[model samples]
Target: KESLDVIKVLTSKVRWITLLQRLTLKQLWVARNVSRVSIAIWKEKSQAVHQYCARWIYNSSIAFNAIDNDDFRLFCEALGQFGPGWQPPSQYQLREPLLNEEKKRTKEKLKHLEEEWETDGCSVMTDACTDMKRRSIMNLCVNSRGGTCFLGSKDSSKDSHTGEYIFEYIDKCIEEAGPLKVVQVVTDNATNNVAAAKLLKMKRPNIFWSGCAAHTVDLMLEGISKLPGIAKLIDQAKCLTIFIYAHHKTLDLMRSHTQKRDIVRPGATRFATCFLTLHSLYEKKALLKNMFGSDDWHECVHSKSVKGKASYETVMNIGFWSSMTLVLKIFSPLVKVLRLADGEKIPSLGFIYGEILVAKNSIKEATYQMERNYEPIIKIIDEKMKGRLDAP
Candidate 1:
């Protein structure tokens, strides 16, 4: 009878504790929901007011004490889930005036962007679609003279041909954006893009048509890679990069084991393999050499050996590095042009014109040098080919 009474008492106590836990959990959920609704209501009323009230509520000693004393410990625990980086408003008093100032600044920026679009020498157009099948074309204008550039977009019908649709969209843009004395339109060599360029040239005869240098470079790079071994070598380099980057703990260990070189950051998968290879050579040469001499490297290289040898020779050549250095040196003047254009205190047109003249001279000099370098190589190849044909 005594043992039965003791068991009954223990069971009853366990039930009470379980019920208490359940009630606490329910209260916490309800509190969180209430807090969320209150925040929503406050936001609807005014962001400034809501921010101010939140600041006060978070900082008040009395509120903290009340929370500490109550069965609302679960609610307090829920509140603690807010991120440590959260910060309340520093100056709530200037809220209205700040908002007004921002609005005025936005209007000024739009006005400036529009003025730039009207006078810009170069522009680009591209299109993208949403999940809802709503199609839109984006037009971006860049003034070589320097100022706020314009970006505008418009929607098109779902069934509309992308090329004709984009052309119509461009026409609408020109009408809305005002007279654009553009000197060039740069785009990818897409059929639609080509048609648009032709149409634009017909509409504005004075405007020169040119393909994007970046796009041209991409195409050239792609063509070069397709030459047997180059693409495979590039792929092997990419795989090596993946091996190094994918395992963070291993990468960290490698860094510690090596000369404490800067570890690659998280989410940097798109980093160029060339740079990564150079870094490995400079910082972790021993580890890289070991890995390169392993079975994995042999397999990757052997799979594309015929092309790999030529690709490796091309990449490792001193001439390739010289060419890269020369290109960088040639484009160095554009950095100054970009800096001058981005100045907040707008410089006079004469100052801008002077800079443009300087840039034009630099470009002319660079082009001359490039032509000079390639002329000898071109002449030799041509002469050799002609001699062979004549002999035959």
Candidate 2:
């Protein structure tokens, strides 16, 4: 109770000190010199009476920690209440007339940053997360050439998740950090994301929007897995991968014994995980072969044949490899074009237009290659396997 009373008194004293300081500073500005004897009397009688109270208040207030003795002296001088030996107060005059001038400068700086962002060809990346209470999409504006420019969010209410709501939030972000000029929005290929991308494209025809490369890869893998006879093989591969991850100690023991190699970590690549995952698996094929060769894993190996000859052959064929290679080839040129678009050394519209043409051509070339490779597989499956097998 006493502590609470002390706090109340301290708060009131701080308020009084602030008022006194402002009043003193105003008077000091008006009077350059005041009589020392008169000042001394005021200091001894009035200032001294308040000194203890001022000290108590100062110690209590957070801002008081930042105030210096010189500032206190200036406050005294401003009031025309300073004692002898005290220095004159510092000038409070500003070179700029208004606080708004500083704000204006800051706004201009922000504009410059925005311009830089636009010139580089920004990409928006979005992801959704659900907390206990709500689901939100975290949208980040990234300079395709480098760093993140801004981050914003859209929240879901009443457990309703819709693309329209996500896009509405994106539109708000665009309005806030706008000239609304961006090159592309790269997002995961969820239904909501696809809808949002389509809406953004309709609203801003100039912007280029696409699914993220990582997401595109995921879709490609899923599509490939859905091919006739491929699903079970892929599932088996996944189960084996999961089993290895789940039985870490057993995997470690195996590694320490026969192979004497390091245990493969959890989330390690499966042969059918993705292009990158496949690449990793290809690199570690010998290790994988050894791991599955053990007596306990013989059944998993035997089940691989049950997924069908066509699925295995299709996966191993040049057509699938060619298609993947073509995609990478197309992406390479597009990535370069995006980088050039974002750079400070702005290219002419004609040059940029030409680069866009090149990107389009690269995509066409990839599509052509995919069809070219796919046709042979389709013909072979039709002739040899009838409708029992499908081309991946």
Tens digits of per-residue lDDT for model 1 on 238-315? 554455555564355445555566434321112222433433433444454444344554455332554444434443
Query: Candidate 2 clash total?
Result: 4
Which pairs of residues have clashing backbones in candidate 2? Answer: 24-78, 24-79, 28-78, 120-342
RMSD to native, candidate 2: 22.8
TM value for model 1: 0.42
Question: How many steric overlaps are in each model, in order?
Answer: 2, 4
Model 1 scores worst on lDDT over the 10 consecutive residues at 383-392
Deviation in angstroms for 391 in model 1? 38
